[model samples]
Target: MVYIRRSNTRVVTERNLDFKEEFQKKLSIIEDGLKTYLPHEDEKPEIIHQAMRYSVSSGGKRIRPILAMATYEMFDRDVKYILPVACAIEYIHTYSLIHDDLPAMDNDDFRRGKPTSHRVFGEAIAILAGDALLTHAFNVIYESALTYSERMKLYVLAGKEIAEACDSKGLVGGQVIDINSVSIIDTSEKLMDMDIRKTGCLIRASVVAGAIIGGAGSSDILYLNTFGEKLGLAFQVQDDILDYKENEIFPDKPTYTSILGIEGAREYVKKLSKDAIDSLNIFGDKAAFLRNLTMSLIDRKA
Candidate 1:
């Protein structure tokens, strides 16, 4: 006998939305929740908390958190229930950015076009603030799992993916390779492997965690992960393409554009974005926002 594959995803509503309008609405909600969830600047150990807030409140697109929420909302409309977990994604992303911009890492002087955390807060406080955000992410996940979830397994699954996404072999490992690559020659495979871990892991985790937490069945989880993976790779490739368009290079380390050339890189991004959108076809029209989001990710400027 033969069997046909199917999507186990569900829909909470059928209202059509202008993609930009929906994105802004969801982004606003995420921003408000993130502010309320973070430590107050005037709290004890004020400078650390201030640094945390400064980075957290910076002009980010809130894409990761919104991706989580959007994926979750596909199966259920309980945004309140998932708000904390979603915030955890933002915290995790922010922590990565803070540390990535430290004097020892990317050694950047800015983030979101503003002074980097280390530039304003000093290195010691910057490091500590990153630590604080990193530690707090787990707490938010654990608390949200216990407090708002009917099925602890859902949050457990989400937490597991989020944690693994930050593992030495995942996000951190990618960063390590990047920093160490200045003197090393790289192949296309090596570059892709590193980028997938460094930049793609969290983006993949965002959607996978969201889809699983949103009540997708086992098959749906697999397909959604595929969607996340494709979308994530496309995002990185597009970033490289954008950089190449400006300066024809990414400073150091290898980029997809460096390996594939400009047109090849654009083709690569286009194919991945199409594949990502096609992955959503399994869920029918319920995944409209996700499809729109995947396409938009490649074209974003900041």
Candidate 2:
């Protein structure tokens, strides 16, 4: 759905022709980029390549990369420059999912309606697939940076952002905390911290890396960073709420709804969602597509 801002009021509009067309066009570009960046399944070490393709090509909303593209577009229309990095972000996200579903992790049998990587390729292959994607993500960024020799520093900074997000103090750290927790997360501070590190870091990397490549100034970068953090947390909270609504919440796991209760969780989502949208004011009408995308995400059923 599209979100239009009228002076002093923000209105929600159904996803109409204009918004759909624009969003679809961008999505098409991102899909094509992912295909081009990924290795061919027939390449050497075909098993690992096949597993990577299988996991990444599985049906899912390509939100992270799309966020990067949209954020980049806010400053520069030439999205080609950012496409590689955007796809790399997806590769990293896909890698995380592969690992998350491993036998040692969540041990799920399916992902995005398809058999999980381990289920399809066996555990060893699945682990290697995740490892390959994680390492390849950096190579994609590096190759893209080489192509854009003049903007090497910007690319370096973008790569660093993604790297740190997935590193020990970020996504991995959060995962460790999640798997190691001996008791239910009873405090808002601890849960928020874990959620931000685990889920929000990569999202923050997506927006910040896009802005960096787009040559945004410090203030703009700060605003987009804030936007990403708030949006990421809101996204997770909403997911918790949905699980609760669907009777899928695990008693052993602590979610936003678990800690805050349903009504309180809903209220938190509203606050975070509003803050996320408000952070885009600096981009003015140029951010309409992003604003609408943000609204749609918060209200998504799945």
Candidate 3:
């Protein structure tokens, strides 16, 4: 049970200068950690290396890896043991985003404010790039096992967890629901189920993987799992809010707001964000970053 003393001072407002500085600092650490942990190209595999680098370095919020590092730090664990797992989590996530943006999927032309993989690389290469990232994520975890014997077991377990989350039982299954539901007119319950498997699963894995790598006890891990589950739902709800906002800007864009109504969607996101913060109470102040990040998700415009 790791804990930090609660401050007597009020919660720092997001507009505070210190909050922006701390957020940027965390983002820098995450970016550097990702670059350091990514595979180095030798002379032999130029194309694969190029695709991997292109997909990963395209720039988005490195939220998954940052969450992993934050959880590891909360428990006073060595960052080294968690770095590989954090990188792997990001790889898996990036792969999903790549595939999600493909022609047969969401058919998006832009992601993270740039051309999507398929749009730039052709569909075949984009598919292969996603496949490579997915498989290479496992490779990273396996390679780490060779060096850290004591941490090897946890790494293996985290790898297995990731596999489960990315497979039919997790993200893919949720995606299947999302595709099928596109024309069906979504109900609240159906949307919840779809988002849980599609987006929530990986977010849940990100937090749990951090706990596993940090060697947290069963109780702590359980609490973290709960936290992740709630956070995951909150994240998707925030995405829904963003979708609605976009629809307002461009009336032609498809959006949840069209289906749920703006006020209803906003209320739903609010409820999810509250639930997410409530789950962090078990971790006390040790979960400060997680708590703040969850709130940030709810408040974000993009």
Candidate 4:
């Protein structure tokens, strides 16, 4: 087994940073960080701040940040140093969801069981809120401190990874294909490509960024990169399964279930999930949370 050097040792205080509790602990930290960094409700231009806050505060799993911290923790890096970067990921994710739900986009009326940002704040406010959240993510990352000297370079590298993921050929590109692929995606490979870009890109960035912050070696970095991509794809497949069960309004959209059937998609999820777990084998027991996370993500209900 290849050993990773220059990584943080696990904090002595937390002996059991594994299982369900670890997941909740990381999620709670991310949730609080998100709330703390969001613009105040009474800040200048109250309406915009309110809209942005509303969007960020809306309930969700906060998985992106969790992924970042979990990866960072696996390398024994102090999670505090990476919190802002992790939070930045959530901001970007929230922005995407808000914009995706707008009238010109997915046109959804609800998110996390509440009215969507646009539905409550109007289309213009929702658009601005998404824009603000996206900008805020980068701004926070740029302004936040990196504890290590090499972290500056790592920051730039990881930031570029995230930016590229958000670019036209990644997140937006995936969404564009989502809109256009109903007729184009006849094969499982083609559909998986679209899913990877839209969902897997950001997820990959989350873990990749964490590894960078933790000073992981090239081999470990490569393993985590593959893990993130496989996990991200599994995540999207799980979402497709959920949508198949909970909603059917978008029958026109291409999904794994649409092409592979529910049983087939479930089997696909198991395959991707196993690949993700295998990716962590290089890390040994240090990756318990991440390995379990892969299973939890697959079994998620909401």
Against the true structure, whose TM-score is highest? 2
How many angstroms is residue 272 displaced in model 1 relative to the true structure, after the best TM-score fit?
Answer: 0.9
TM-score list, all predictions: 0.91, 0.94, 0.88, 0.90
Q: What lDDT tens digits, residue by residue, belong to model 3 across residues 208-287?
A: 88888888888988878887887887787777677654436423333456656788778877787777677778777677
Clashes of each: 0, 0, 0, 1
Residue-by-residue lDDT tens digits, candidate 4, 102-189: 8777899997789999889899988999999999998878766454544678777778888899999999898888777877887789
Ranking by TM-score: 2, 1, 4, 3
Instruction: List the pairs of residues colliding in candidate 1.
Output: none
Where does model 2 exceed 4 Å of error? Answer: 5-15, 182-184, 245-250
Off by over 4 Å in 1: 1-17, 245-250
The better-scoring model by lDDT among 2 and 3 is 2
For candidate 2, the TM-score is: 0.94
**Candidate 2 RMSD to the real structure:** 2.5
lDDT (CA) for every model shown? 0.84, 0.88, 0.77, 0.84
Better of 1 and 2 by lDDT: 2
Q: Return the lDDT, model 3, position 192.
A: 76
The digit string of per-residue lDDT tens for model 2 on 1-302 reads 55553443333334445666788897899889888998999998899999999988895788899899889988888988999999999999999999999879888998888899999999999999999999999999999889999989999999999999999999999888888653846777788888898899999899999999999999999999999999989989989888885443436768887778888899999999999999999888888887888888888999
Q: Which scores higher on TM-score, 2 or 3?
A: 2
How well does candidate 4 score on lDDT at residue 141?
81
Candidate 4 at residue 145, lDDT? 41
